[model samples]
Target: MIIDLRSDTVTKPTKGMLDAMMQAKVGDDVFSEDPTVIILEERLANMFGKDRALFFPSGTMANQTAIKLHTNPGEQVICDKYAHIYNYESGGASFNSGVSCRLLDGNQGMFTANQVLEAINPDAFYYSQTSLVEIENTTNKGGGACWNFNEILKIKEVCKSNNLGFHLDGARLWNALVAKNESTKQYGDVFDTISVCLSKGLGCPIGSVLIGDEDIMKNAIRVRKIFGGNMRQVGYLAAAGLYALDNHMERLNDDHTKAKQIGEVLSNLSYIKTVEPVETNIVIFELHEGVNEKEFVQKLQENNILIISMGSNILRMVTHLDYTNTMHEKVLEILTSLKF
Candidate 1:
């Protein structure tokens, strides 16, 4: 049996999800007539207490659009150095928005209010004006660590005092919400713009929702057009998103539990030097000296259990909707029996 743990994005739609897609009532979305797409957008927006939301083809586009909306050209965005907007996204912040980023050094991709205040540039014309602050929940590169909610509130207060726009790259916010026992309204009240992905943990084929005030979302439609994200009759895919929202969220705790199990195994292994705390569904660990990363990955692959090597010594494994309990048992057996 082949087990793929590279990322949750690899999850295939289940039979129920496919059925929903096949039965979706679709219409052209560019002109705002797609019934299913509109329903999905409205459901997510209301869940977060936002006035409106727009669907995008990908989370990157959703995030880049938020960056463009909150800041003018030549201004800077503040975020953790490990943010997906800064590291991933193909440099879209500068390429699409003509804006720069002021990265902060935070614990596991989460920074404090003081860090935000310190990162903000002065009113002087010499530095890039800091107009926006972006935060990622269940920070991906930080081993899916959830931010402390109190720190989020403090950062929001700082943004309010600084008059800076606050945005959330909430691609995995559902995991954070479940792991942290936080409410959607709490996030809705803090952020000016929020991007939530349907394709990752939610198990949809493709889609991300950007939420904000009606006026902000109105402008987002034009931005989506510019980004080549405008689609017609894509409600077939939106139907899968709607279905996932109804069925897939609660099961995320299972993924989280399995990830912690894998993390515990790694922590006890002789070849592992350190394991990043597994807060949700992602497990990342560092190999001890004298262990070849490529060879280690190949060993697992040869065992029919696939994972990802983040660097020469770092490995990443993501638990997802499709990773069954039987596969989990197989992985546990393989790890326990293997000798490095």
Candidate 2:
């Protein structure tokens, strides 16, 4: 069997999740009549203690919508240089929102409150006005690093004092919540808008939800429409989200456990250069300066094991709900036996 460790997004719906989807009562979400979708939205909103929640087909849309909702044209956003919005969202912030990003040189994908203060543009006509700040938890590029919640609170204070809108790219937030022992309402109290994904560790086939106050999110639906994110009969997918929320959250720690095991094995190997601390399910490691990443990835593929390269010499493997114990043992055995 092929062991696909590329991302948590790769998993198929579990039998239980699919059963929920098949049984879901669906309606046109564009007309706000999908009962199951409404329930999912309200459940997440109430969990976060927010006034409203809106669903999107993908996390990128939810995040871009938040950016658009918070800023006007020719504005700026502050984020880490390694943030998903800056690095992976394909310039949607600039192309769709007409805003540029002020990338802070941060640790992994996290930056300091002091960095936020420094990155703000002077209120001069020549500079793009800094209006929003976005952060990612369980930082993908940082080998699933969980942000210190205290630092997040400090950043929120900075945003409030500066009158800047704060947004969270919480795609892997369930993993963070489990790993860090943080609460949802605490985050709801801080960020102006928060986007969480259902397709990552939660194991839904598709969807992300953006949560925020009614006043701040009043225009979100309109923005979603303009962005072509409106849906009909989407409760079938929403049902999977609802099911995953109920059944899939606590099991994420198992993924984290297996990832740490992989890191431990990699660290002991003489051929491996360095491995990032495995805080969650992502294992990022680099090769010695001259080792070819493409060759290494090819070797794994040749053995029917799959992962991804995070640029030259750096590679990533993500453990998820579907990465079984048998697969884990096989991967470890293959890794231990590999040679350049």
Candidate 3:
């Protein structure tokens, strides 16, 4: 069987999820008349102790909306240098929000409150005013490392003292929550806006939810409309989100367990240089200097195993609902028997 380890976004809906989507009562979501979408939003909002949640078509759109809500044009966002917002979002912050990111050097994509405090620009007109601080939980580029909840609290204090808005790119926050045993309310107590992705880890076909207090989210729908994210009868997708919340959340630990298993195998391999500590579903590792990245990937492809190359001798594999124990075993076997 061909195994796809590229991302959790590749997961297809289960039969049960498909049934839910087929049975979902849908309406025009642009006018807030979709019953299923409304329930999904309200359920997520209450879970995080937030006043409201708005749905979007993608994690990037949800996150970009949060940035727009918190800052004016020309203001800057302070975030980790490895942030997905900077690396993967196609510069939506600068394109849509007119905000530049002031990136901080942090361990495994998690920075200290002191780092955020130090990165904030002064009130002087010469500098781009630091209007917001954004962070990604379970940082993707840093090998899916989860942030310390205490450090997030510390960062929030600095933002509060400086009157800066706080935002979370929680695309993989479900992984962090399961790995760290963190409660949603704890995050609600910190960030001004939180973007959580249902497409990743949760096994939803598509959708992300942006959560915030009512005042912060009041203009969100309008912004989403301007971004061309407004949808009609989108409750069909939101139904899958609701189903995943009920059935797919706790199973994430299985993906984590499997990822750590992969990391264990990589660490023992001779050609492997380093395996980034696997806390959740993503496993990132580097090859020895002389190892050919292209040949390695091509070899795996020949075996019908697929993964991603992050260039510079680095490779990434992601565990997901679709990556079964059988596929995991086959992949590990191939990895163990590969000849240089």
Clashing pairs in 3: none
Better of 1 and 3 by lDDT: 3
lDDT of 1 by residue, 1-340 (tens): 7999999999999999999999999998988899999999999899999999999999999999999899899999999999999998899999999999999999989999999998989999898888999999989999999999999999999999999999999999999999988889999998999999999999999999999987667789889899999999999999999999999999999999999999999898888899999999999999987888898899999998889988869999999999999999999888877777
Off by over 4 Å in 2: none
Worst 10 residues of 2 by lDDT: 286-295
Q: Using Cα atoms with residue i matched to residue i, what is each candidate's TM-score against the true structure?
A: 0.99, 0.99, 0.99
What overall lDDT goes with each candidate model?
0.93, 0.94, 0.95
Model 2, range 124-216, lDDT digits (tens) per residue?
999889999999997989889999998999999889888999999999999999998999998999998999999999999999999999999
**Position 102, candidate 2: lDDT:** 93
Model 3 per-residue lDDT tens digits across residues 1-340: 7899988899999999999999999999988899999999999999999999999999999999999999999999999899999999999999999999999999989999998888988899999999999999989999999998888889989999999999999999999999999899999988889999999899999999999999999999999999999999999999999999999999999999999999999999999999999999999999999889999999999999999999999999999999999999999999999989
lDDT of model number 1: 0.93
Best by lDDT: 3
RMSD of 1: 0.8
> What's the C-alpha lDDT at position 1 in model 3?
77
